[model samples]
Target: MISGDVDAELRRLADDPSFPHRDAARHAIRFRAEGDVSDLVAIEDDPHPCAMTDVVFAMAGSKRTWLNWVPMPAEAICNVANEVGSRRAEGEDLGLVSLALSAAEPASAITASERVMGRVELGIGDFPAPDIRMPLRRGRYAIWRYDGTDPVPAVPAPSGAAIRVLHEVGGEPWSSPLSGYVQAEPLGALPLADLLGLLAHLPGPPDTPRWEYLAKSTPTYWYRLLQPWVCLGILRHAADEPWATSTRREVLLDLALGIEDWTADAALFALVTAAYRESELRAEVHQVVRARLNAAASAPRLVTIEESLAHLMLITPGCTADDRALATAVLARAAEAGEEDEDEQAPPPSKAEKRRWWQRRG
Candidate 1:
């Protein structure tokens, strides 16, 4: 939409080798004039390039420097604590003592970091789940015994002392290339319109081998956005947004089937896990699985795709007969290609694994 002398001046700035902000100028010009010249941009120059970056930049304000994100809902605190407890019980060197403090009926805590904030609550009749842990942060935590009902940040209190310095909880750092988003702002601060804008403008499937190879090196911010806990939390918070109604499901289905990387599995995982509570999403997942299975007949099945199929069989609820048949045929194709079936290799768990089912990127 940019035209007139302004467009000419911007283009000149972008093309001027001596202009210190030439790259920014180029991005501005590219942003205003649509149609992807992304193909022409060097990977080094656009390491985490995606429409989401544009959305995040505009929404977060141009004056910021770092992105502060809360990766999970408050409920995930209990999950993380329970897993740490489990690991300690098994004599593993998780290096943390277990705490069992009784709070009057409902226990509440406030989870806050840099820009994001949420509250964790354990209701009177309900206790935390056994082995469904989701990690939130990665650092040393101070655990204190407080009797009052005032909300606090913490892990479960151990039996020994009233206050203790708890070493960092065993969790992976949620670092992404988009960690530095040109400024400091809480992810919770982003508006639903901006979030949906990013979702709607996501790049479609790669059509070129160069893009495919590049995908292996530079991932979109969706890698962080679509993490299981983050995606689930967003769905909960934006229950009224198009995410709850239709936009999320549609975008996820497209990414699950179109994208060909861990991000795709993340998309697929979000679809299946969200389906656990939403019947409409469950139906959508079934349709996606059916279509994906049909396409597997000829498409080159990568490990990511195989693992996605395994997740479908393992976690997807109300699996239909037709869907199962398609999956079986797809696994057969994978076998012919000499790829190991992930499901066959998985050991039955004594308790549900409290981590992402799919392999993590090293």
Candidate 2:
């Protein structure tokens, strides 16, 4: 523990140019200090793991950001992807039973429970049968079902692209809100835009919410995409539809909650009709995300994402830089608003002024 009062320590740290202690202090019982006073009030019940993962999520059902973080050491962000793998292996988390089933050859696993119609029959990624409430118990081991109803929580996928990115540019330990949030650097390999595009192509139970996982899963493809702003943007686009239930809407909610990057992969899926890039989208969105990621531990979700995006130097990744550059451009535009140009501010055109102008023109 650092010496001195919390406020005093905060003051000392605030003087530094860069954001530090940002990652190490997330979700702790003891109160911590922050550069922005707003940051302190934003995370009122922070530090406790159970305070609510989605507190960071804009919506009530939004997914967790930490789980699918491309950058290592997500502070205060719940790393559910890592947990799911561990839990599934131990038979602790029932949610992930589907991954194993999907990996297995056909006829390897059997189910006895009644599955909902149009549930697993159609097609898509192998998913869990959340509808199947109970376990398949028998002789030696209990047989779990994979009806493909539920979605898997993505941590960070370690594909060649990701490894290449990390290996090249590399990452620096992040600035987080959690204490002892650990330190690591980015292997600064610029991310490719088209990772997990398959999410778009997957056919699912039409009647049931096609994009239900957007609201169901704790850490979904949304926040993992690292573009909550994109969700808000798309939500604005579909606000008029009212009853429109496209996968796009579901995808937007995930984006808002930080499950998936809306711009890079999500938007591309809709525009180009691709799914193979969905995971790649998850992987690539990080570029824009890191651009906006503030001290994950300190600022409110809004502020953190904004600040992080604001400080980014270069964003060469999957999606266009419109939203990425939007922050500063907006601010610049706002600043220029009040100042009137001398030419425009000239006295109202009177008879004399008009005559002078006319004479000059002649």
Q: Which candidate leads in lDDT? A: 1
Candidate 2 scores a C-alpha RMSD against the true structure in Å of 24.0
| lDDT, model 2, position 115 | 17
What does candidate 2's lDDT look like per residue over 1-362, in tens digits? 22235444344444545633322233111222212212322333234423232222111111112211322212111223334323443445434222212211111101100011111221222222311212111122111223353333222333554333332321221122121011112211122211222122111112223223322332222233322222222323333443235444444323322321222222322221111112334333444343323222122221212322332211212333554455455334323532432335566653222221211010
Q: For residues 1-362, what per-residue lDDT tens digits would candidate 1 score against the true structure?
A: 11246556766866889855556566646634541223112211345546543332232212111112322221223334434434543556643222222211111211111001112232222223311011111122112123343333233322211111101110112222233221112322334333332232222222345334423332222223333323332243334566544555554554455523233444555565455434556666766655554543343212224524543443344565555565666556545533432443565521212221211111
lDDT of 1: 0.35
lDDT at residue 144 of model 1 (Cα atoms):
18
Clashing pairs in 1: 64-182, 64-183, 65-182, 65-183, 65-184, 66-183, 99-157, 99-158
Candidate 2 segments exceeding 4 Å error: 1-8, 11-159, 167-173, 176-191, 194-362
**How many clashes show up per model?**
8, 66
TM-score of each: 0.31, 0.22
Worst 10 residues of 2 by lDDT: 108-117
Candidate 2's displacement at residue 299, Å, is 24
